[model samples]
Structures are given as C-alpha cells and as structure tokens.
Target: MLAALPVAVLLFDDEGLAYANPEARRVVELDATAASSPPHVEAPAVVDAVNRARRTGQAIDCELERDGRQWQVSASPTACGQVGVVITDLTEVRRTDTIRRDFVLNASHELKTPVASIQALADSLRLATERDPARAASMLESLEREAARMSQLVRDLLDLVRLEERTGEEEPAEADLAELVRTQTTRVAQAAAEQGMDLRVDVPDVARVAGSPGDVRIVVANLVDNAVAYNRHGGTVTARVRRAGDEVVLEVSDTGIGISPEDQQRVFERFYRVDPHRSRRAGGTGLGLALVRHAVRRLSGELQLDSTLGQGTTLTVRLPPAPTSVAAPAQPPPP
Candidate 1:
C-alpha cells in the first residue's frame, strides 16, 4: 500500500532507513542494502524533520529547497517505532503565488497614476472654469487625455485576460499575415506621421498562417503601435511580412530609443515599460507588448526581440503556415 502512494514515503528507525517506497527512492538516494546502510537525504531540512518527529513522537512539517526545486516534507511517528516521511513538490505552486502577487501590485500601480491624474484634473478644471476661464479649455483637454488613458488601460487589461483564458475550442482558420501587417500598419501610419516619423510596410502577396484572425491582428497591431509610440521624431518604423519555409514571419523594426539588454528580457511582462514617462506621454497603457506576447503564444508562435540602447529595436514573430488547401478571405481594414 505504501508503494502505491503518489508522494514520496519512507520509513526510518533509530538505526536508519528501514523502508523506502518507489516514490521515496526517486526523491532520495537509497542504499543497495537497506538492512545494512541508511539512505541519504541530501536536504538537511528533511533529515532534521525526520529526526525531530522521531524524538517528539509527533508529526513535523518542513520545507526545503533541493536541486533548484522546492519541496514540502512531512515527517511523523509511525506505530512501528519508525518515522514515516512524505515529500511533495511545491516549486510550481510557490512560483505561481509569487507571479500572482507581483501582477496585482503592478496592475494597481499602473492604474493608480491615471486615476490620480483624472481626479486632480477634474478639480483643476472646475477651478479654471470658475475663475480662470482662459485656462479652462486646456484643463478640459488634459482631463480628456487622462480619461482616454485609463480607458485604454482597461481595454488592454480585458484583452490580456481574454488571451490568457483562450481555450482553443474554435477551429483555427487561415489568416492572411501579409494583409494583417498592411492593415495594422496603415492604422498607425497617421500617428507615425504626426510624430514626424516615416512609416513603411513590405508584405508579400499572401503570407498566410493557421490561427485566429483576431489573435493575428492583436499581434500585428501591438507591434506596429509600439514601433510608432516609442520612436523618435523623424525616425523610421517598418512593418514587414514574408513566408519563411513552413512559417509566416512578421517583423516590426523601429529607429527609436532602444531597450536596454536587461529591459528586453522583461519587456513582454505585463505593465513593464522601459521609459515610464515617455510611455505615459504617448498614451501607452504599458500592456501592448504583453498582449502581443500572449497572443503569439496562444497561436503556437515564436517571438524574438533585438535591440541596441540608442540605435533601434526589432521584434520578429514566426507562426505556423496554414494548410495549402485553406483559402484566406479578405479582411476589412481596421477602423
């Protein structure tokens, strides 16, 4: 019965290890002859828990880290004058908890800035309207901008949630990657032009991929938007799509203030921004790249980033090609 348990179980007497189940043998080194030599548990914490449980004749629980993994060890006195031990892995659980905590803190911080600005702007606008009529217009404009920023943040948050919860229940369809690049690029071209930046698009006749059109559009739009948003005045933003063997490749490159090596590693993380001030000024929600990352992963695609601090940054995405027999329909330009 002990051998059938899923968790690691061991029976140890005062002399040493009397029995180790298959699960326990997998977790710790067992001697060839259990009757002669004691088994070795590399983790000191586990050994201590067993010794303490035997000495006190009570159950003792402890946690330990071994071989870069987290383990929860429980040792208890058995009826046969031996200590019974159980070990369960807790690495994924602890890591998930840490991620959940960080995500909440970051989301709260991101929302707080816009909320506070909206509150202050409303107060100033009221004062301006009453006593400083000349400045009232500008205050109203500022208030609108803050409201828009918050709205965009909420929308992006929803998008992130949807992407994370995607179940792939719907059949994948063939989406024209080339068309998505062109359409998303055009949508952001005016913004690029307003910033005195040149926008360019290079796409093949048809670069099709097997994925949901919505997911592909999210990936393309965010990349193009980021290129335009982070670029310097008079910089160039290029959106390109091509067929690469069995994959469809989309690359967005920008001559902008590039990300540092350290920042690049974490840019896809939710609410992470290399230039927080600039990001806010550009009406960024700081969730665009995160949306792109999630959408790409949902489609079983690969994403890569290359950048230099002052020169430029380029993001590349490769997705599986659609079946040869599938036909991609024309997608209307985004409004």
Candidate 2:
C-alpha cells in the first residue's frame, strides 16, 4: 500500500526513523535516518495528524515550507501507534502564483485610471449642455481635451505593454551611440522649431558603444525630447556625450520650467505628471520617464536628474564603457 502512494513517506515513533520512503528523501534532500528525526521547526499539522491517525489508524496529510522550498507534508499513525509522514516540493508552483498576481494587479490599475477619467469628463459635458448653453460650450471643449488626453494615455499604455513583453536579456551590439543621437535629434529637431530652442550635440566621431542602439536611443533621445518639449520658447537644450573613466556620460540640459522637490520622486511613475493640466494640454503621455527607467536598466546604466523649478533641468545617463572585447577598433599599425 505504501509503495503505491505517490508522496514520499516516513514512519517513526517518538524516538526516531522507523521507516522512510524514497520520495521524502528526494523532495527534501533528506536521508531515511534524518526523516524521522525531530524537524527543526515545529509542525503542528504533522503532530495533530499523527495523534488523530493513531486513534483511527488512518492516513492523513499537511503542507509546509522550509529554506525557500515549498512542500506538501502529511502525517499518519500506524496500527502500532507509530507516526507516518510525507513531503512533496512545491517551489515552482508558488513562484508561478506570485507572478500571476503581480501581472493582474499592475495591468488592472494601468487600464482603469484613464478609463475612469474619460467617463467622468463625458458625464460632466452632458450635464452642462442641459443647464446652460454657454457653459455647455466650455464643457464640450474641456471634454474634447480630456478625450485627447485619454487617447494619448491609452496609446502610451499600449506602448508600455509591448515594451514589457519584449524586455529580455537580448540587446543590440557595436552600436554607434553617437549616430543614434544624430539621427533622432534630426527628426525631433523640427518639433522644437517653434519654441526657438537650440539643440546642440557634442559627441566625438570616434566614440561608439556596445548595446542596443534602439534602447540607448530611447534613453537619451527621450530625455532630450522631454527637456526640449517642456522648456520655455527661448530655452536651450544641450546634449553632450563623452567618455569618463570606465563609463560613458550622456547628458541633456534644459532651460525649461523645472520640477519641484515633491514631483521629483514620482516623475518615474507611470501616468504621474508634475502639472496635470499643463502636461495634458501639451499632449504629454506621462510614460516617458517610466520608459527611460526601463531602458536604463536594460543598458546597465544609471540615470541622474537635477532640476530647480522656474530655472531648468538636466538629465544625465552613465553607462559602463564598452567591454574590452568590444572597444573602438585599434588604429592601423605604423609602417
């Protein structure tokens, strides 16, 4: 009967190991002798099961975890009043459960916030239209703006989902970090045209890095874009890239309205905005900093931010220099 059981079983008296099956030893890495020995921790379930089974002479079970290992354990008493116990490992099962719960919670909060805002704006517009024509017009305008904001929020959320799914150990190789800056700046330069903001780049031609070009672009370009977008019309956005010891430093400084000490801590959180009305009106998606954080981690880099409200902001990214194996090519040998 014990041979037919799926679990690892151990039988013993108050003294020690009277019996131990193969499964118990395999699951807990315990020998038959060690099985019946007093367990390090008190297992009430095992003690209760042993006492009850001794009276009925029946089999029973329990569950427990030790040293980060999950196990289902059972205890029973034999006809002679001795105890029988079993343990089965469950580490993988518990890990799967935790991952599932976190995914569900994060997804729910992200999808719900924008949806609630949109619904409230629509309801307000409807009430205003019924009571006052002039107020209705104002409400409609406000509703339109909120609807656009919600639309952008939804788009950014979708982008985040896609990025999260795609994040893995893989990254780009032998990427000319400087070129990426040149290309993206050229494209975003037009957007800053109306602001009269000056976009300057100071990257050497020989400089190159080893990482995903796309990720590095996301980290640096996003910061520069944000700095330029948020700056005053006549502000300056200066981008500098250089090697400092074993790290590469890429910085973007702006003369825009800076962040307050309060909003600084939360700037990296999804959907957080320093100035909700202004950010929304400017078509800010609120996912930029979150994206920056993700990209920085992927590149094995650090991001530093400094800002003073009413003055400006500066963002710096420091990445480990390309590995020795991937450093810029050696110069040609002399004749």
Candidate 3:
C-alpha cells in the first residue's frame, strides 16, 4: 500500500532505513543497496525532520531547498516506533507566490503615483479658483489629464487580466489582418502628425488570420501607439502586414530613440519602462508592450523585437493564417 503512494515516502526503523516507496527511491536516487544505510546519507534535511518528529512524538512539517528545487518534507512518528517521511515538490507553488507578491507591489506603486497627483491637483485647483482664475483653468486641465491617465491605467490592467485568464478553449474566428493594421494606424496618424512624424502603412488587400478580433486589435493598436508615442520629431513610423505561407505577419517599425541591449530583455514585463520620464510625459501607462505580448500569445502568435540604440526599432508579430475554407471572400472590385 505504501509503495503505491504517489508522493515520495520513506520508512525508517530503529535499526536504520527500512523501506522507501518507488517515488522515494526515484526522488532521492535510493536503491536496494542503500536501504540498509542511514537516511542522512540520502537526504540530511529529511533525516533531521524525521529525528525531530520522533523526538517530539508528533508530526513535523518543514520546507527545504535541495538541488535548486523547493520541497515540503513532512515526518510523522508511526505507532510502531518507525518514522514515515513524505516529500512533496513545492517549486511551482513557491514561484507562483513570488510572482503574485511582485505583481501586487508593482501595481500599487504604479497606482499610487497618479492618485497622489490627482489629490494634490484638486487641492491646488480649489485654491487657484478663488485667488487666480487663469491659473485655475490650467490646473483644471492638468487635473483632467491626470484623471484620464488613471482611467487608461485601469482599463489596461483589466484588459491584461482578461487576456491572462483566457484558457484558449473557445475557437477563434477569422480576423482581417490588413484591415486591423489600417484602422489602428489611422487612429494614431493624428498623434504622429502632431509630433511631426510621418506615418506609413503597407498591406495586402486581404490578409486574414485565425484569432480573436479583440486580441488582434490590442496587439495592433498598442504597437502603433508605441511607435507614435516614442518617436523622434520628423521621424518615420511604418506599419506593414503580409501573408507569409501559413502565417500572417505584422511589422511596426519606428525611427525613435532605440532601446539599449540590456533593456530589450525586459521590455515586455508589466509596468516596466525603458524611459519612465518620457513614458509618463507621453501619457503612457507602461503596460502597452505587456498587453501586446499577452494578446499575441493568446492568438498563438510569435513576437520579435529588434532595436539599435540611437538608431531605430522594429517589432514583428506572426500569427496563424486562417484556413482557406473560412477566409473572407475577396471584396468585389470598387463598383
């Protein structure tokens, strides 16, 4: 019965190591020859736990790290003067806890900045309304900007959460990649113009992909938005879409202050900013790339980034092409 247990289990008698289940043998690399040896030789931490349980006449639960993995060791004193030890792997659980803690901390820090600004601005606006009407008008604008920033932040957070929670159980409908690129690019063209950046789009008449339209929109909009937001004055931002064999490819390139080699590795991390001051000034929530990454993954796509410091940057995404059977019929020639 003990041998059938899934978790690693070891039985130690007064003499020495008495029995070890298959799991225990596999986990600790124990063999028949080692059965007669003391348990400490195999796992010192397990031995210590067993000793503590035997001494106290109760079960002892402890966590330990071994071979770069987290493990939970539970030792119980059997009724017949033997000790039973169970070892369970906890690496994934511990990793998840760490990620959760970090996310909460980062989110709180991101939110606190805007909340504090709004409070301060409100107070100043009140004072200026009575003393200086002109200044009060400017304060009102600033207040509105801050409020909008906070609103955008909240919406992005919700979108990211939704994308992460998706289980890929629902079948995705076909989306027009070319149309998505054109619409997203057009939406950001005014912003590009205001910055004196030339915007361009190159796409086939019909490029279709199998994915959620919302997910694809997020991916396209964020890419275009980032290109416009981080570009240099009079620079060029180009978006291109093409069908490559089994994949639909979208590429957004920008002539901006490119990312350094070191920063490229973490560009997709939530709330991470390569240039925090510039990001805030551009009304960015620092979640654009993170959202793009998640949305692309949800569509079973690949994202690539190439940047040269002081030169330029380009981002590429490849998604599964929609099956020919479901491809949108080519539109009738402009009547």
Q: Write the per-residue lDDT of candidate 1 for residues 143-251, one digit (tens) a residue.
A: 8888888888888898899999878477859788887888888888788889899887777767778888988988998898889988999999988776666777889
Query: Candidate 1 or 3, higher TM-score?
Result: 3
Worst 10 residues of 2 by lDDT: 325-334
Full-model lDDT for every candidate? 0.85, 0.72, 0.87
**What global local distance difference test value does model 3 have?**
0.87
Which candidate would rank higher by TM-score, 2 or 3?
3
Candidate 2 wrongly placed segments (more than 4 Å):
1-159, 162-168, 324-335
lDDT of 2 at 334: 45
lDDT of 2 by residue, 162-266 (tens): 566775567447567766777777877887777788887777554566677777777766787688778899788887777877877788888999999998998
What value does the lDDT take at residue 289 in candidate 2?
86
Q: Clash pairs of candidate 1? A: none
Q: lDDT for model 1, on a 0 to 1 scale?
A: 0.85
Off by over 4 Å in 1: 1-6, 29-36, 325-335
Backbone collision tally, model 2? 4
What value does the lDDT take at residue 123 in candidate 2? 84
